[model samples]
Target: MKTERPRVAIQGIRASFHEEAALRYFGENIETVECNSFKQTFEALQNKEADYVVMAIENSIAGSILPNYSLMMSYSFPVVGEVYVPIQLHLMALPGVRFDDVKYVTSHPIAIRQCIDFFDEYPRLQIVESNDTAACAKRIRDEQLTDTVAIANALAAQLYGLDVLERRIESNKLNFTRFLILTTHENARKKTGANKASLCFQVNNEVGALAKVLNIFAHENVNMSKIQSMPVLGKRNEYNFYVDIEWGETRQFDNAIKQILKYTHNFNILGEYLKYEEDTQAPKPAPSPESTKRYITVRKIE
Candidate 1:
């Protein structure tokens, strides 16, 4: 008898970016448990419906998914690994459907927003928001709607037997999304040689309290890759800090964490996992903010 394959929960239907990221991390052999929302994805893991979940934490064009941070705090699932998948948006429709036949396009709102440039040329096309990009494509195929199309990935086009109406329609060609692999705390043991960690903490309302915590990491030579502050509810002028750090020396990172505890309240080490460094899918360096300002202005005029 064969053992069951690992069930990986994802936040969208098959061929969505979540599924693509799941396959990148778990290989093609894993079973997928499709969830309607990120909350549902975590619930699937909590209910033991899935062995692991692949969730997008951030995207190059859309910044961070803030609600996911709140969910992580509530569920306290350990992040075991991560994957960075390149994002490529394509406009696809039913087989043999002509571009002129597409009166409306549907997809996740973010997908629509990313392809703003392409849509500008077709001012008459009605854009509709849906829960998932691939789900919209599936809807088009299942409904046999020749007048509708979905802005999704190449995988969605192949999965639904749709023809690509427009390729690489997104305004940004160097888009990528970072996904986190989450599992129950019992199964979230960090692998040996882990070089990165995620931490969350609240600091005492005092002068230099936040800076003192940063100073410790600096002293230990820990590289702070990302830090975000979320407002604490029911409290005025107070916030919770979420931080990601990378370190070259394990001792230095460990020592910084020990020192940081003394200066913080409700300190929690979310997880420590291997940093994603897949060069093949890695993004090109982004343009500077000053250089991008001109492009943003041009987009508004267009």
Candidate 2:
């Protein structure tokens, strides 16, 4: 049976990375429902305004988008797939504007922080923050603001007819963002060939409880790619673990989950999907965000 093109909800305008990621995964025929915020993107799905949503869960440079994980846990949306897009942030502005003429640099706060080194050299330029990188470019083009430049993807420059003042200005050359493809439980259950799984669980506040759970996966030989602990609000010292594991043998992964359940409490399998595979190009190692302050400054335009 031929599947109908899905209505994809994405954060930001059509040229944003979220939209590009969606197209890369769902193809060109899918209809896009642009949302101004990530929360709104989930609301679109919940309200049946969209069939699926493309949400950025993490970035190589910025690390995990923690709030998004909370959103997933709250909305209970099933992750149907995943995509990793190479992020190339460019400095762009209206035509005829030179580097010296630019007084204000604006982009999504995360985008601005990724290019911090580039901005550090230009101390005179005041940095501003916007909700979306593509929207920043759109504002400069729509308002004919020559003094303001936007840091966004090449697609944003093309779509907004802005000139690229500088290309690949991000401090980290290996910058890439991973997006989660989400759908309702009914649609997600119909997916097949999943080799990776995302899970959430809680363990008793006792020594060796968590270790026992980890040992099960180790015994089963399932590669645990990522594990994050989010503190359960109002419950001191108790955390909800979010884990991602990849398995070559489905039977082994199944057995590991079965064994893990015996040691953990309130275990929830968030999703099972095919792992995202990039091209043969190797990524350069970037600084881990654990030591650095993840927060960025933002100045909204009135």
Candidate 3:
């Protein structure tokens, strides 16, 4: 029997990239809840207000989204799926406004940096920080800030009824963002041929202990994708290491993870999710919002 599509929560407003990722995974028109922050999305998922949460985990230009990684390991929610979106930034302002009329431009700091080329000539223009690029666009539209412009996406401009003052303004042409699809339950990445597994571990803070644990994967012929450490807050000098491993359709993945657990403490299974792009090699169109979806929020920044 086919299971019904699940309601999901995504951070940011209607035109946010996170929302686009959610739509791509869940299908457009499925129930969705908009969150003001990543934490709020986590809360919706944890409280069972929504069936799943989708969030940006990393960007090609911006490095890893540390907070999301920390959230992944801290929260009980498991990483189930991943979606990659090609990012094309646009400069927007109230309709009918010319570029010379612009007095201010704002966005998330990371976003401003991503499109530095478009901004360099107007360094004299005040740069302000908003929660995000889309949120900034919404503010400009809502307040009718005629002199103010924003660096965001075309979708944001379209949704907010703003005019694109500039196009593809990102410094890098290959801008793409990677987002994760998360769930409260395990086995989100049910066995499909050729999958990736995310796992966390904490060695005894001894020299070479970390490498020894990784050796297990080497012996098993598993491919490693990423490795990073986060300071275990309040735990003094102790940091947790996150790893992504590539394994073929074989039971050895489970066996290897199980064995690695013995060598480290806090050995947790982050998620065993399938990469949508890896198999399809094509992008999926976003689904419409699901009003009936349940949700839980994990983070909220005021």
- Residue clash pairs of candidate 1: none
Q: Number of the top candidate by lDDT?
A: 1
- Report lDDT (Cα) of residue 178, candidate 1: 91
lDDT by residue for model 1 (101-135), tens: 77999999998999999999999999999989989
Candidate closest to the true structure, highest TM-score: 1
Go through the candidates in order and give each one's C-alpha lDDT.
0.84, 0.83, 0.77
Model 1, residue 263: distance off in Å is 0.6
Predicted candidate 3 versus true structure: per-residue lDDT over 180-248, tens digit per residue: 888877425464664787888789877888888789888887878888789898999798888888877
Decoy 1 TM-score against native: 0.90
After superposition, the stretches of candidate 3 with alpha carbons farther than 4 Å from their true spots are: 1-5, 186-191, 278-281, 285-302
Q: Is candidate 1 or candidate 3 better by lDDT?
A: 1
Q: Candidate 3: deviation at residue 263, Å?
A: 1.5
On residues 39-61, what C-alpha lDDT tens digit does candidate 2 reach at each position?
Answer: 98888888777778899988887
lDDT of 3 at 215: 91
> Which residue window of length 10 is worst by lDDT in model 1?
293-302
Ranking by lDDT: 1, 2, 3
Worst lDDT 10-window in candidate 3:
288-297
